[model samples]
Target: MTSRPTPRRAVLTAALAVAAAASPFASATPAFAGASGSGPGPAEGAVDHRAWATFPQWSAGRGAGTRVIGGTRPGLVIGDPIGTHEYRDPHTGTTAAWEYATWLSPVRTLPAPATEVVVSFNARTPAGTWLQTELRGTYTDRTRTPWYVMGRWTSGDAAGDIRRTSVDGQGDGKSSVSTDTLAVDNPASGLRLASYELRLTLYRRPGTRLTPTVWRLGAMASDIPDRFTVPASRPGEGAGHRLRVPRYSQEIHKGQYPEYDNGGEAWCSPTSSQMVIEYWGHRPSREDLAWVDPAYADPQVCHAARHTYDNQYKGCGNWPFNAAYAATYPDLQAVVTRLRSLNDAERLVRAGIPLITSQSFLASELEGAGYGTAGHLMCVVGFTESGDVVANDPASPSNAAVERVYRRRQFENIWLRTKRHNAQGEVRNGSGGICYLYFPLRPTTRQARALASVGVR
Candidate 1:
């Protein structure tokens, strides 16, 4: 029997209310050092910047330890450096450590009709030491005479591995953590908040030698209502965006070309492009896989062009990879400018397109069962009222079974890596101007058949 799609609108509504009730006033403001103004939100097709606040500056600790803020410190740094640590256990002979970092910002009035506030981050084990982290948020009501712990969320990781943690809890403390999912709908106080704080403390077990290094932190604002009900229709239904499946029949197995398998060439973009061509029947004139490599790939060589393409992908492609790819593009300034244009979620909604993509091999072990290490792609067909995204992942083996529903924040972080910023500063592979492709929902029967022939339905 086929599994039924979850009623997202109802689920999101219920989840939001539950979250609000559970964790009443967990605080979140903005990032440190970054001022909160009406700047654009995250770039289009990229993760939205949920809140604005100050960075949790590492205050002086008791013992002698180095404190670094806004930048990297060499070694033995105290407090939170990217939210992880390595410390000597004074009590036991074993080396002890913790991963703790906080993002604090001042609260302006809450967004209109917003029933709750949420916080999210990414935690990973650098050296595979048994590690666990907790997500804590604090909120202080400025109006109240004496500040109180308005709300808090305490939950463990969803999957039991050490790769990373994504925590989502409501004001009432209904939360879960997982490796490749975005945790959202955490409830903060309904009262106007003066300040918000996020903290993570990581420490080694009773007997372990591994130190922790934090990779990413992703947080956002959400509109989880106070009551459970179906969500209103989206702003531009049937008017702007539509889904379209393609048509093609080509037998292209994974290992058909030894050069692709042996890494003789960078196959990520081309392979994806080929999938698009085969699935959609739109082949580019330039058959040579290396056609655009010289002008677009190789960050060291094609810097400016790469940035332009990256920016174009985000601003025009309306896909997350567009913004993500800017991270690797040669020209940093171009990337910044492109990213700046997409500053808010409203703009993305206006675009009438939802960016969708996927990652592979990173969390294969945790992806239930039967799914393979080969990564895949799909579009977010729509959002359910319950704060879940309706996704169309074409590569999954089952047809008609292509549609999936996921928690909004969890899906965003897992698919887009919103929490983990790229340190190497490389363009994301799926961004436009490379291998990524976009299609509307309305398609001819032939196109649909072709898509079905492959794994995309």
Candidate 2:
């Protein structure tokens, strides 16, 4: 394990305390084996993919394999960190097996009629290899669907974030990639997301070596019904003061960082990440970001994307991955969670922690955020005196144009609901409320209570 700075250790201790109090699953052990709900179903994968155990009996491959090590962060360690050995049929020489390892999480029950499921991991792998994450679910009647390939992610230049594909039901790395995020959408078929499990597979090319490690894994299921609605809420506690968060615009890097997903136009996540990190007084050093162009302003934004990239997912906006990257710095703590409402956001800001949120809204729906996006990320720094939202929107044409105040009701509609376009151009079902909390240290007791009440741990 890498040694943490003294200040970081203090933060970790406090974070642990907070988690112990706030999270019911904090110290619970993951069952590791997937579960199948009642009903007649097909047999599941036989290989035991439990983390930290000896490798399972596969179609091929040899050696002792790896072990799952425990720490402030627990991860698997591959004994054979380098080298490529193809395990194939001796008779045909057709490559039957490539070097790989798998881990499956215990099954989780999803909200009924879930239209889409989002899975994320906090992982670090050597430069060449990629991590493939898959999700498979069982219906209430016990019918099992084939494994849905969520994404494949390699570190640095090869990361592919948010990959969706039509899977061939095979657990190998050859599944086709798609732009869709839905894993199981059978509203008419009578199949609802009952119980689902996750699998991680590692892949590497010949002549390359590096062990891959995963720190944390998470997934969430959303129904995203055809219509959208949000319940009424009481006033936020901190309805007046806005934090002085530094702004960075994704548009400024539009043409640059092409190695990433089309540069700044798709860089809302990284730009928002940069704003919060800078607000906490830690900037990546020149040597740290030496690979980026010296001519570009705020090169750290690009640096953030590179480090947060998932080779298989093919994008840089993985929620937990970005939060994990921020925690790399000293005295910083970050976690990805869904906030029930803006009152949850207000508590964090009141505690001096800025939030990075994800949403999809039309240009006309959100005032001051010029332009519509199928998806985007921005920082929620604070609230106006009358309970409006204060944000650093990186989608602006320039950095100076990034700060904006948005009306409370309108902002909530965009932030918390799922939506689709109707025939008359009306937006429906806008239900998405995902955010990451970035903080320098523990907040006051009252602030922590508020954060805890809103599920912000």
Best by lDDT: 2
State how far residue 334 of model 2 sits from its true place (Å).
Answer: 5.5
For model 1, state the Cα shift of residue 222 in Å: 2.3
Total backbone clashes of candidate 2, pairs 3 or more residues apart or in separate chains:
30
Score every model by TM-score.
0.33, 0.69
- The C-alpha local distance difference test score for the whole of candidate 1 amounts to 0.28
Q: Please identify model 1 stretches exceeding 4 Å from their true place.
A: 1-114, 122-124, 128-195, 205-210, 224-354, 357-457
Tens-digit lDDT track of model 1 for 1-457 = 1111111112122344334334332233212111223322222121122321112423321212223334432112224334345544222234544444332323333332222223332222333332232233333333222211211111111232232212222233332222211123233334333223333344433234544433222233223223211122233322233334321111122223332231111122222222233333333334323334443322211211121121111111212222222222111100111111111111222233233344332233224223332233344445554545555554333334545654554444334321121224321211110112233234356433322221122
Model 1 per-residue lDDT at 238: 21
How good is model 2 by TM-score?
A: 0.69
- Each prediction's total of clashing residue pairs, residues at least 3 apart in sequence or on different chains, is 59, 30
Evaluated at residue 412, the lDDT of candidate 1 is 41
lDDT score of residue 316 within candidate 1 = 14
Ten residues in sequence with the least summed lDDT for candidate 2: 1-10
